[model samples]
Target: MRTIRRALDLGCDFFDTAESYGPFVNEELLGRALRGRRDDAVVATKFGWEYEGTARGALNSRPEHIREAVDGSLSRLGTDRIDLLHQHRVDLEVPIEDVAGAVGELIAAGKVLHFGLSEAGASTVRRAHEVCPVSVLQTEYSLWERHLEQEILPVIRDLGIGLVPYSPLGRGFLIHRWVEDS
Candidate 1:
């Protein structure tokens, strides 16, 4: 709790938490941490997991669950809109186009401002971007993680999407919010 507060005090407004994180407790924890400062923060969260049977079930990114997921996130985070919403992982059970479409609808309804993908391949990113312009791609790419450069970076560059590499030092949880001094 103190660490999170210190980060916020240091001008860290973007916070990432998934419903799957502790199956719900993380968001509640952040909500308490952000209590009266919701307007001053940018909350990014993810969808695509079966929260009901979290400990024992499969990933669920079906279009039918998108809105409900967002609603749950909003309620838990105590926010009306998500600044950057991500598909935690690509779900084979659901088509990428359908996931994009679902998130696109959320944008139309003023629930989500931007869409993103995590741990996804280049082709999946392209397919989803065709349906909804991806503002960012959150894949692991760092000192020891350079796989994205060979293929993913090119597409991200071509599409003008931001690349957010997840270094183990900093997992793919809003690391984009931090920038080193030039």
Candidate 2:
């Protein structure tokens, strides 16, 4: 926490967290850390899954749920506005436009600055963008996971949306060559 605080003190403006990570513990930690200095950082957090106290997965992206999720996120992060809010995963149960529209409303209400999607396909991305301009697309893209390069990357680039590649190091596999066997 001290190291992270030092980095934030030195002008590190962006931070990302997800609902699945600790199922909200991480966001709470960030909220506590940034308490009075919330304006000094751009806190981004994601939502999608509902953890049932056993690590079980269930997708819920209904409009009402999105609204509720944002409120919970705000309360957890102790912020009035989220710099960027992302749908951690695509919910096949809901229409992309509906999801985008919900986020758009939040943006309009000044609850969220930008909306994004994670691990979404190209077509869905297009539809979502049409409903609401997406500022970023978070996905796994790197030398190993070149799948996005074939379709997703082109659409994002052509649309002028930034690509925020998570796991750019392939989950530490990129540095495997440097690890010596015990």
Candidate 3:
């Protein structure tokens, strides 16, 4: 909680959390921390997996599941609308268009401000964007992981979609030694 307060103090506002993280714990913490200050922050969360009493199951991005997941996320985050809602992972069973369409409905209904995608390929990004504008694309990108540079980057850049690179420090690999040294 102190760390989150410190970040907010330092003008850090964008916060990203997912339903899968602790299956709900992290979002709860964030919701509590941002209490009375939700307007000052941009909250981003994801929903793509099925959960059975806190036990995460397989990828399930079905339209109906998406609706249920967002409602759960809204309640957990204690927010009326999500600043940015992402499809955590591209579900092979559910078509990208369907996923985008579902999110589009949420956006139209004023439940989500913007749409995002995570770890999605170029083709999938394009298809989803055709259904609904992809405001941002979050992927594992850093010096150590340059896979997206060749294909995904170009596509997102061409589409004018913003990129939110996760694990920018190589998921702590760049700081592992630093932590050990400390």
Give each model's whole-structure lDDT. 0.85, 0.89, 0.95
lDDT tens string, model 2, 108-159? Answer: 9999999999999999999999999999999988777889888998999999
TM-score of 1: 0.87
Order the candidate numbers by TM-score, best to worst: 3, 2, 1
- After superposition on all CA atoms, how large is the RMSD of candidate 1? 5.4
Please list the residue runs of candidate 1 whose C-alpha ends up more than 4 Å from where it truly belongs after superposition. 53-56, 168-182
TM-score of each: 0.87, 0.93, 0.96
**Model 1 poorest 10 in a row by lDDT:** 173-182
Tell me which of candidates 2 and 3 scores higher on TM-score: 3
Let me know the TM-score candidate 2 reaches against the reference structure: 0.93
**Over 4 Å off, model 3:** 180-182
Provide the lowest-lDDT 10-residue window in model 2: 173-182
lDDT of 3 by residue, 49-97 (tens): 9989999999999999999999999999999999999999999999999
Output the better candidate (1/2) by lDDT. Answer: 2
